[model samples]
Target: MRLITYRHDGRIGTGILQNDQVRPFVGEPAMTQVIEQGIGEVADQGIPLADIQLLAPLRPTSIRDFVAFEEHVEGVRRSIDGATGVPEAWYDAPAFYFTNPHAIYGPDDDVPFPAASVARDFELEVAAIAGPDRTIFGYTIFNDWSARDLQSREMTINLGPAKGKDFASSLGPWIVTADELSPYEKDGFLDLWCSASVNGTEVGRDLLSNMGWTFEAMLAHAARDSVVRPGDVLGSGTVGNGGCLAELWGRNGRQAPPPLTDGDVVTLTVEGIGSLTNRIISGPEHGPAVPARRRDPARARHERQH
Candidate 1:
């Protein structure tokens, strides 16, 4: 079943997505609540899916992004240093980051491209939202927006991607449950295809079958001692030759990074999960960052020790 987190009449809730209708799951707080409580009985009694304000499907405890696409990695590595091969460490284990859940946006929303972003681009990826508490429930489509020029410049300092990636990351209209898409495992392939359109013009497109590291492997590598709780998310890095700006405006292209202008509407579509349409509103004025409270220091310290 496709699960969704949404708000109706200013109240937020979770439900199952069936056809074009959203079946509401009463007594469930959010997707996070359901994941912590486990599935089965609650899912069986979900409400009908209809018109609802689809929020980010879950309140992720963490967002772990992995370098699952070798070509994308190789492409970046080569561009940076003329390196011919990927680093041994990059291949040894899965690498990820703890992203702000508050940074997440929903389908049909507007993305504020900060003025600091001179080169804005979109990355087509498959994002997995953990559902079974510490388990990878299933995969969904993701768009990792990037500021190519900013990222490239920061690499020289070797502290990388903080401001470059912290601004925005997009996820679904729904978090597809594993049982709904099990074929994604057996054949080690998914027919899911991805595409991006800016103001009705197609910019990025690729097949999900192109990933170098499978979802299972990425999960195993990410879960190695770290507990990926329900509502958490994992992104499958960009696909091959699918660099939004690297291939278009980086050294690979004839110009500098292609900067998105005001009023540009960028729509990302994945075959099964549906489309995420976001308009480019004037930065800051569009909306403030959803203020996330600072992490609790005592809890933070305990978590670190574990």
Candidate 2:
């Protein structure tokens, strides 16, 4: 079953989507509640999908995005510094980063263009939403928007993709329940075909089976010393074969494609999960910039001596 959160008649509620119509749950329970207690009852009649505005299926409690595709890693590294092969450490374990959860957007929503960036890009990925007891509740399309210039600068210091990545992330058309996608599962990885496009032009496509790490392994890595709470989202980072512009740049010897601009529409489709589309709009005005202080050499030496 597909689950969605939508706005109808000026009211927001969670519902079951079927045949392009929505059957709203009895009391408009929160999606987290729906994840915990199964959808019990729904209205007899359904509302036309076009009449209501769809919201993000759920606001994730936390988001952990992992680089599970080796080709993606090699390609991105090549783009950054002309490096050729995947790092040896990458083979040891799943690597991931926490992204902002508050900046989530739904299908058809307008994503703000980051004011500080000119090299905006999108990553085509799939996200698994957690259910109780560390199990997966469902899956959805995830567009991990990126500010390439900012990311390149920050990573030069070996630290972050924080401000670079925290700007926005798009999730959903709706959630496809785990069972619905079970038939596609093979050896802990799904055999789904994933594709991405921008403004009617195809950019990339690859199979989810290309991922080197399993969701179970990623979850185990994530929960090593913490909890995998319900509503937590874990992203299967970009698939291989041109999943993002950076990877394409690497493949093309650093010749870059036009970055995402205002009014551009990005669409990502995963065979069983459905499509997620969003438009880019101008970002909010920039705040005052912060400057870094110069290091004091004498103080540094004295501290070292002490």
Candidate 3:
């Protein structure tokens, strides 16, 4: 079943989407509650999908995004640093980073271009929603909006993508439950076709099967020495073959396509999971900038040695 959180008649609620209609849960249960328990009871008849606004399927408890596609890593490395080969350590285990769960936006929402960046881009990916017993609840399209310029600077310092990434992320039209996608599963990976487009122009497409690591393995790595609760989200990262402009630029020897600008629309589609679309808008005004302090070279060297 496809599940969604929608707002209708100025009220927000969780529902099951069936043939353009939404069968809302009897009580306005939180999505986390619905994920933990089952979709208990629902209104027999349905509300027209057109009457409601879809919200981000759920407010994720946490988000763990992984670089599961080797080609994507190679492409990004080439784009950023002109590196040609994948690092040997990448093959040893899954690698991921935690992104801001609070910055989530739903389908059709407007994402702001980060004020500090000029090279804004979008990443086409699939996200697995965790359920009870370490199983997956469902899947949704995830657009990891990036501020390439900020990310580039931060990575050179070997520290962040934090401010570069934390501004916004888009998820959902709805979540397609695991059972609905079971037929497409092959050897722990889904053989699903995923694609992305900008302002109606197709830019990239690839198979989910191209991922170097499986969601189960990534999730296992996440769980090591820690707890993974239901409602946690695991992203499959960007798919190869033009999943993001950075990858495309890397593959084409650093010749980049235009970065996402104000009013640009980005849409990502996964074969079974439906499409997620969002528009870019100007970022909010900033207050004041904090300048970084320059340390004395000798003091810095002494501190590093210690």
Candidate 4:
């Protein structure tokens, strides 16, 4: 089932999405309630999906985004200083960072243009939501929008991606239940293909099997001494070879595509989970310009080599 959170008749509620139609669950209207009770427990009332606007499947209690793809890890490192080394900690355990949950957008919403960003970007990924009994609930496509310039500057400070990443993160058209994707599993990885495109130009494609850390491992790591609530989210960072301007700008130096601009639409698609698309809107109206503009990246890299 494709579980969803949506707005219809001026009210927000959880529903089962199918064939462009919504079957709203009676009484238990919020997705959190359905997730806590399990998908099978919800009862339904029918509504045309066309009549309702799709919202994000649900607001996760918290979000943990893991850098679980070796290629992505290596690529990002190379993008920075051209190093191909993987941190020892990444191999021994999953590495993740918390992101702003309040900045999330629904599939059909517009992502506000981040004012401080010049290297506006999108990270194509898959996200797992915690469901009943602290196990997997379902999956959604994730667009981890970024401000690459700010990210580079902050990384040098040795603390965070901070304002660089908190701008916006988009999830869903709907969440496909784990059982719905189970048939695609082989060995221990799901064989689903994930891809991203900007303004209709294809950037990259990767398989979920390429993930270095599995969902179970990520969720376990997230739980440490705390709790992985039923509405919590776990992200499978950027897919290997996924094109965000940051990674591409490094490799195609001087010739890379321009960073995301206002009005550009980005789409992240995972085979079983469906596509999450959002258009950019320039905004925040008041913030300093991205600080990385002061440095010449190409010249800096040249200096490093000497």
- Residue 212 of candidate 4: its Cα lDDT? 87
Name the Cα RMSD for model 1.
Answer: 8.0
- CA lDDT, every model vs. true structure: 0.69, 0.90, 0.90, 0.81
Query: Residue 195's C-alpha lDDT in candidate 4?
Result: 84
> For candidate 3, which ten residues in a row score worst on lDDT?
249-258
**Can you write out model 1's per-residue Cα lDDT over 182-206, one digit (the tens) per residue?**
6554367665777877788786677
**Which predicted model would earn the best lDDT?**
3
Task: Put down candidate 2 lDDT per residue, 3-26, tens digits, no spaces.
Answer: 999999999999999999999999
TM-score, every prediction = 0.81, 0.94, 0.94, 0.89
**What does the lDDT read for residue 138 in candidate 1?**
67
RMSD of 2: 2.2
Question: All candidates: CA RMSD in angstroms?
Answer: 8.0, 2.2, 2.9, 7.6
| Candidate 2 stretches greater than 4 Å from native | 295-306
List, residue by residue over 1-306, the lDDT tens digit for candidate 3. Answer: 999999999999999998899999998898889988977899998999999999999999899999999889999888877789899998999989999999999999999877757888999999998899888888999999998887887788777578879999898988899999999999989999999999999999999989998888888899999988888999999999999999988888755677888889999999999999999987877865698888799988999999
